[model samples]
Target: MAKVSIVDVAKAAEVSVSTVSLVLRKKGHISQATTDRVHQAMAELGYVYNQSAANLRSQKSNVIGLLFDRLESDFSIKILKCLIRELEKQGFIAMVKTGALTADALTLAVNELKTQHVAGIILVAAGSVDGGLTPVLSAAELPYQVMANQGGLGMSDLIVCDHYSDSLTLTRFLLDLGHVSTVLFGGELHDPVFGERANGYLEAYRERGIPARKAHIIYADTDLTGQRQRLEAALRSDNSISALLCHSPAAAMIGAQSVLKLGYGVGKDFILSQQKYVTCFQEVDRLSDGVMDLSYILLPLEEMAHHAVRQLLQRLDTPEPLPGRAFSGALIR
Candidate 1:
């Protein structure tokens, strides 16, 4: 049987071979009707791009796949935006997909990106998602890196921000401020980042000669109402703790509302904050206003994104696997 080629596809679709190539590569602007006609012609001809076969024949794809659970958090937004920008700067296209935090949902996203023939994948598993996703990702047999989320998942590389170290620094700073006790106000316990931050908080207390108190490490629901209730309850249960180490910006907002509801000022009795980016303050600072004397960390989102893109491209050339790396955040008052 004669194999179908781009020329045959163009002839069958009554379009130029360039048009067929453009449609196949998902490049340039092709009308939907024409694209459909070209696809129909290809289907009639049983045509496939043969990506794996082509890769073996000395060709490299300049596309990067970026997968994420969701894009609601400031951290997710910042990281994705920077990554895409950096990818474009280095002459690579970014294909981004997002879905629910479940393993199946993540698998679907990975599979869809796979269909696009992305050269490498940057899985931005931000937020409180943790679970069995490494298998599907590793099975893809493509160089992939996971950012900001971990679960013993197998991948080519892992990149993360140092949540534990930074959280420990923040906690120690709170202790230095004459606050005898501080509470890790709110976060999901299952998230790897949250767990690290929580550990840092405990370590800070332990190193300060204060015995670890179970009450200091409290986890809260992600919802605003649930967090507000938790904050109110925590405040009532112990007012001696003068500060909160919120793992999220939403949690900080809730804590602020709870403090106000109890007729107490922000800086006078309690302080709250989590993280932010200096270049894009509006997105991070929106939740900080009315929260009183908030001290947030400056996450180098742009720097992280640039490094991830650069590393992924280099790995594509060398195909050498590297160990996971964590970047640290700077404190911003």
Candidate 2:
């Protein structure tokens, strides 16, 4: 069988070849209905758009590069799926690269994406790394965006959830429930993301004129066993601690289990709250059913993904540096 061509697709869609070309290039003011018809025609005719040939002619490709320092969390995975889906709807594809967060590794990754002629790049959670990408990405001269928790580069457009504000809200909710001695659990002490959240928790206490106890803020170890030990010890030593504000779902789970093991009723004898990606909240709810009373802040993972895609596309069109965007999460009881 012969390979299907754009002309065949144009004929089948009952549109001119130039219209089909415009649709393929994602340019011109094409109607949604007509675009759908052209896509259907291409699918029926098994016509594959030759992105390489198009790139050679236009010197650009409708490919967005996604760089990740790490992609290990449920939050990262869910946001990644959302980004890919939204990008595809706008007639673009994602090329993802994940590796160590070293400066050399990041520079190499940016260089590789540039070689692929990707229209733009999105750096997800890469700001956590020590050496920032401002110089590397600026030198590459490509339109790029950063989706991170904290500390963005100077040159890139950043899309971040308001962690400090959300944390303050969550902590205030717990305080309003009359829990004066609340403990903050999990996260690395030195991390900027953790610092913002911890500061928010502190600020809530400051607002209430309650002296925040230094001992109540406990950073979790990387391993579960260590966290369990520390949490159990904290509970045993502090009889006044009646509530916990966990930094993540995992920390909340551990706190709940530790409470139970200590012969305490979760909701009755203690209160537990956590921060969660919207996609993973159901799982946390399921696990905590009848076992713990859980309140949580829902991180705007999907919202951030949608905004990131839109901002990157706009950057591609205009190539002007825009100010960063911050989204706020909601506290759900």
Candidate 3:
């Protein structure tokens, strides 16, 4: 009924508590025989050392929280992998959680991680222009970094792909392909990141002396199915549409499939380019002909993680405060 402790192991092994401690830690010049006895006694008594409790005494939990917008999203998985590898290198274990897109969900997740006594948190914000989490994270006092999302607040470190600029680049590339009519498929324009990319799309058209038509700019839904329906309808209505630029890479694959289903070839009929971050796949096929390479932007996730972890550790080690930092991304062909 009682929890097993080191004292019980020491008593059973006929050794002092100090000797048992030294043996358990593999320190203090304890003899091999005494170490063996301590181990056997521990096994016999079913004693488990409370490492978490010990870690609390040292004021470092060696735990980091990874919060994502959607667990199943492809970009989320890519960023998570990079974050895990970086955290492991720093000698910290990463605990991952997802579906923290809403305000209540984000608040609840932060509370849960706090209960676990995590040292820092890496949040993959949904980049909703219609919403914000800066106030919530600031209130929670959780040292955090924003990943796969744009940075704005001073409370956290921000690592984001330059969505606005890259969108313009992709759109211009489509124009350069001699495609007169262009359509930009995007998610919520209320999200900051999406909003930025949408602005880029509009700016590209305006610069090229093209009229900014709302009908040409289709704001897709957040998920894949919604985006597929929206894109399919847009393309089906106007078969004259020759170029398509999308902001969601995961949804872009679906768009490609939709294009195929409509008896249109991707590289030939519709020049396609995804404006958002892409995961490193084993072999990426070029979606559009005449393009020098696969049309996509690649976020530097490892570098982002390195900056985030460094900031988090600095906050943990010293008492100095840091302003919110922003990291930009690059376009990969």
Best candidate, lDDT: 2
**In terms of TM-score, how similar is model 3 to the real structure?**
0.60
**lDDT measured at residue 152 in model 2 versus the true structure, 0 to 100:** 53
Stretches of candidate 3 exceeding 4 Å from the true structure: 1-59, 98-117, 128-143, 148-157, 186-193, 213-215, 221-240, 261-264, 268-293, 317-321
lDDT of every model, 2 decimals: 0.69, 0.73, 0.66
Better of 2 and 3 by TM-score: 2
Instruction: Give candidate 2's error at residue 295 in angstroms.
Output: 1.3
Ranking by TM-score: 2, 1, 3
lDDT, model 3? 0.66
The true-versus-predicted C-alpha distance at residue 144 of model 1, in Å, is 3.0
Where's the lowest-lDDT run of ten residues in candidate 2?
274-283
List pairs with backbone clashes in candidate 2: none
- Residue-level lDDT tens digits of model 1 in 2-64: 867889999999999999978877889999999999999989999987443333223247788
TM-score of each: 0.66, 0.74, 0.60
Model 2 Cα displacement at 138 (Å)? 3.0
Model 2 per-residue lDDT at 297: 74
